[model samples]
Target: MSFADQADRTLEILALTPGWHRLRDLRPDCDDETVAAIVLEAANFAEGVLAPLNPVGDRLGARVVEGRVKTPQGFADAFRQYAEAGWLGMDVPEKFGGQAVPLTLHAACAPLFERGCVALMMAAGSTRAAAHLLAEVADQDTANEWVPKLATGEWAATICISEPEAGSDVGRLRTRAEQRDGEWVVTGQKIWISFGDHDMTSRIGHCLLARTNDQPGTRGISLFLVPNEIDGRSNGVSVDRIEEKMGLHGSPTCAMRFDGARGILLGKEGRGLPHLFTMIELMRLLTGCQGLGLASAAADVAEDYARERRQGGRPDQPPVPISSHPDVARQLHELRSTTEILRAAILELATTMDIARLEPQSGLDDFTGWMLPLIKNFGAETGFNVAGAAIQVLGGVGYTRDWPLEQYLRDARIMTIYEGTTGMQALDFLTRRLWRDEGRGLAIFLQKARDEIDAYATEHPGASEAALAALDEFERLSAGMISMRDDDPDGALYRADAYMRAAWSVVSVWMALRLSETNAVAGLAAQFAFHSARCA
Candidate 1:
C-alpha cells in the first residue's frame, strides 16, 4: 500500500492514544493550525531538501583538507537551505530566533533529518540541542548572546564527551577544567567530536566534559561551554585530525586538542553531569531519530529496489519485484515491522517528552529520564539491522557503490556505536533508571501502558479484545518470570529488555491504534498504523 494510505490508518490509531490527544490539546501556546503548519513544514522540508542528499552525500563524501574538512559538494548549500528555512531551531524558544515548536512537533521533525544523512542531520540537530542546553543552563548573558546566533545557524556546536581513554566511562575522562581568575582553562583531548572541523559555521562551540577534581566517579565531571574561537580568535584549540570512518562520510568527525582553552562553565560548578543531561537526553532522542531516519531511508530504498529488481519474474505477476521473493519479502516484512515498532516507540517517547514539556506538573521528567536509553538503544539497533537488511535485499550489488545500500549499511553501523552503545544504554537503564526512586517512576510507566491498553480496548472492541488477550498472556508470563526470579534480582535486571519488549508490544500496538484514529492531521501516521499490523 502507498505510505499515504498507510498514514491514514496510522493517524487513526494516534487519535485513540491519550498521549496523541494530549498533543492535539497542548498544541503549544501557538494556535493549533500554526503549530501544525510548522510540523508539516519541517516534514516536507526534510523530505524535499535533506532526503535528496542521502544518496548524493554518500557518493560524495566529505573531503579532509590540510587543516579542515569540507562536506560533500552540495552538502553546505543544502545545509544552508535547511538552516535558513528555520529548520535548524524548530523547538528553540521563539524568544531566541527559533520557532520554539513544541517537543511533539520537534519529535516529528527528527525522522525527516534521520532519513537524510546522519552526518548532516546530527550536524544541524546537535547545534540546536546545544542551543537548548545553553538556554537552560548557561549564564543569561552567555545564552542571550549565543542562543540567537546559534538558532540562526550562524554557528555550529559539538558535545566533547569522549577522550582516547574514555568513551562510556565518562568518569575516567582526563579533560581538565581549572579555574583561572573569572574563567576556565580547559586542556585535554576530545576524540570522536563530530562536525569537529566543518567550515559551515564561522565558529564552533564544544560542550566539554572535563574532570574538575571536585569529587569522584561521574559526579566530578563538569560541562564547559568552550568556544573553539574565543573573543573572535581561535582559543588555543586545534583540530588534530578527522577519523576515517566506515560511513557518515558527509560529516567530519574530528579529534580535537584543547590547549588551555579559555572557556565558560554552564550550570553549577560541580553539578555538571545533571546539567549536561539537559543536552544528553535531548541528543539521545535525536540520535534515536537518527537511527530511525537511516532505517527509513534504507527501507525506502529497499522497497523501491524490491519493486523494481526483477529476479526471474514476469511483469504479469502481482509480486514480480524481488520483494516478491519469499525470503526477500520476509526480510522486508521484518524490517518494516521492526521499523514500525521503533517508530511507535519513538512516538511514544515523543509523547512523553511532550507531556514533560507541556505539563511539567505531570512529573514525567523522571519518566522521560527512564525512557531516554530505551529510545536510544532500541532505535539505533533497529537502524543497524534495517540498513544491513537493505543491502541483503540487493545481494552482491548491494556491496558496491553502484547501489547506495552499502553506504547506508556503513553509515548506520556507527549509530549503534556512537551516542552511547546499546550495552551501555541497557546497562544504564537497568542499574540506574529502573530502580531509581525505588521503582516508583517505573511503576508509573507500567501503569501508563496499562491505561493506554485499557483505553484502546474501550475504543475499538475487537482489537482491544485481541490486545487485551495478548496483554494477559504477557502479564502472566511476566509475573511468572518475576516469581521464578523472586530470589534473583539479578535475573530480573538481566531480563529488563525482554520485559521492556513485552511491555512495549502491548503499549506500542495501542499507540499505533491510537495514532490510527486521528483524522485531523497529516495522514502518514494512519497509513503507518495499518502498515504496521500488515508488516507485523
Candidate 2:
C-alpha cells in the first residue's frame, strides 16, 4: 500500500479532528484544508521520493571521501526537494523562513517522511531541532544569522554530546573550550554524532557541549553553536570517520575532531546542559515520532503480506490467507493496535506541547517533561517489537533483505539507545522527574489520565471501565513504588524498569480508551487492559 493510503487511515484511526481543532485554535492561519494539504503533500513525497530510495540507500550507505561524508544515491536531490517545498520550516516562525504551522501538524506529518526513509529524515530532524533551539535560546544576532538558513534547509545541524568515555554521563565529557580573542575555540572529540558530517548541504550546525572551567562534573559545561565553515574555509572541524553501524546506513554517524573551531556561545555560561537540554528534549519528541512512523509502516506492510500469503488452515480445507490463521491474526491485531495506541499517545503529547508553548504558566511544562521519557522509551520499544512481529508474520522472507522488516528492526534498535537509553529514561523518570518531585508529577499524570477516562466513560462503559481498572492498578503500583523509594531505596532503583514499563502500559491503555471514543474498535481497550493487567 502507498504511504498516502496508510497515513490517511492512520489519521482516521487517530481521530485527529479534535486535535486539529485544538491546533486551529492555536494557529488560526492553518485551517483544516491547509493542514490536510500539507499532510497529503508530505505523504506523496514520502511515497514517491523517499520510499523508492530506501533500499538503494541501505545498500550503498554513506561513505567518507576526502574530509566529507557522501550520502547515498538520490539523497541530495530528495533533500533539496524537501527543502524547496518548505517542509523544513513547517512549524518554524515566519520570520525565519518558516510557515509557522501548529506543531501538532508537524508531528502528524513527520511519520510519513520517517516511514519512507528514516535516515534521510534524520538530517531534516536535526535541522528542525537546531532551528527551534536557535529560535528559543540563542542570542538574537546568532539566531538571525543561522535560523534562516536552517529553517529554509540551506544547511543541516546535529547535537554533539557523546564522547569515547562519556555517553550518558555528560558530566564526565573531556571536550574543552576557551576564549580566543573575541571568539570561543572548541577543541575536542565527539562520538556518535548523527548527521555530523554530510554532503547534502554546504554548512552543518553543531549544538556542542563542552567544559569551560575547572568546575567538576556538568557544572562548568557550556553550549556553543559551531559551524563547519568559517570565511569560506574549514572551521577546524574534521570528519575523523563515520561509524559502520547496524542500521540507519544512509545517515552519517560521525566521529568528529575539533581543533580550535570557532563558535558562538549559546544561552548562558556554565549552564550548557540545561540549554542543550532544550534541543535534546525536542530531539526526543521527534525520536518518538520516528518510532511511531516506523511501526506504522511495518504494520502496513505486514498486514498486506498476511492478507496475500496463503498458509495452513483447517486440515481438510484448502489453504487460506495467512491472516485467517488465529496466531497470525493475533500478531496483526497486536501490531496494528499497539501502533495506533502509540500514535494516539504521541499526538496527545504533541497537543500538550502546543499547550505548553502557548501557555507556559499552565503547568503543562511539568506534564510535558514527565511524559517525554514515556513517549521516547515506549514508542521506541514498541517500534522494535512491532517490526519483529511483522517479521514473524512474514515468516522466513522477513528475515532477509528482500523485505524491509529486517531493516526496520535494525533501524529501531538504536532509538532506545540514542537520545538516551531505555535505562537512562527509566532512571530520569525515577530519579529526576519522579523522585525529584516526590510523586507530584506522577499524581498529576494519573489525575489527567483518570479525567480522560471519566470523560470517555460517559458513552462507552466497557472500554472506559477496562481503562479505569488499569488506571487503578497503576495507581496502586505507583504508590507502592513511591513508598519503596524511602523504604527500600536500593530496591526501588532495582525495580525502576518494571515500574516504568507498567506505568507506560497503563498510560497506553488510557490513550487507547480515549481513542476508542472516536475509533470505537471493539476490543482495543480490552487488549490494552489485558496487557496492562499482566504488567501490574
By lDDT, who's the top model here? 2
- Candidate 2 achieves a global lDDT of 0.85
Task: Locate the minimum summed-lDDT window of 10 residues in model 1.
Answer: 519-528
Task: Report, for every candidate in turn, its global Cα lDDT versus the true structure.
Answer: 0.72, 0.85
Each prediction's TM-score versus the true structure: 0.86, 0.96
In candidate 1, position 226 carries an lDDT of 86
Per-residue lDDT of 1-536 in model 2, one digit per residue for the tens?
56887667656644543444565676687765766777888899888988888888888999998878989989999999888898888789988888877777788888888898999999998899899899988999989989999987788899999999999999999999999898799999999988899888889989999899989999999999899997789999999999999999998899999999998899999999998887888789888888988898899889999999997878799889999888888889888878888888888888778877887777777777888999999889888999999999999999998889999999989999999999999988888777787777777788888887787776778888888888888778777877888799999898888888888888877767766645545368866777778887
Residue 525, model 2: Cα distance from true site in angstroms? 2.2
Number of clashes recorded per candidate: 39, 0
Task: For candidate 1, write residues 312-386 as lDDT tens digits.
Answer: 666676446677678888788767766666777777777778778778988887877777777887788778888
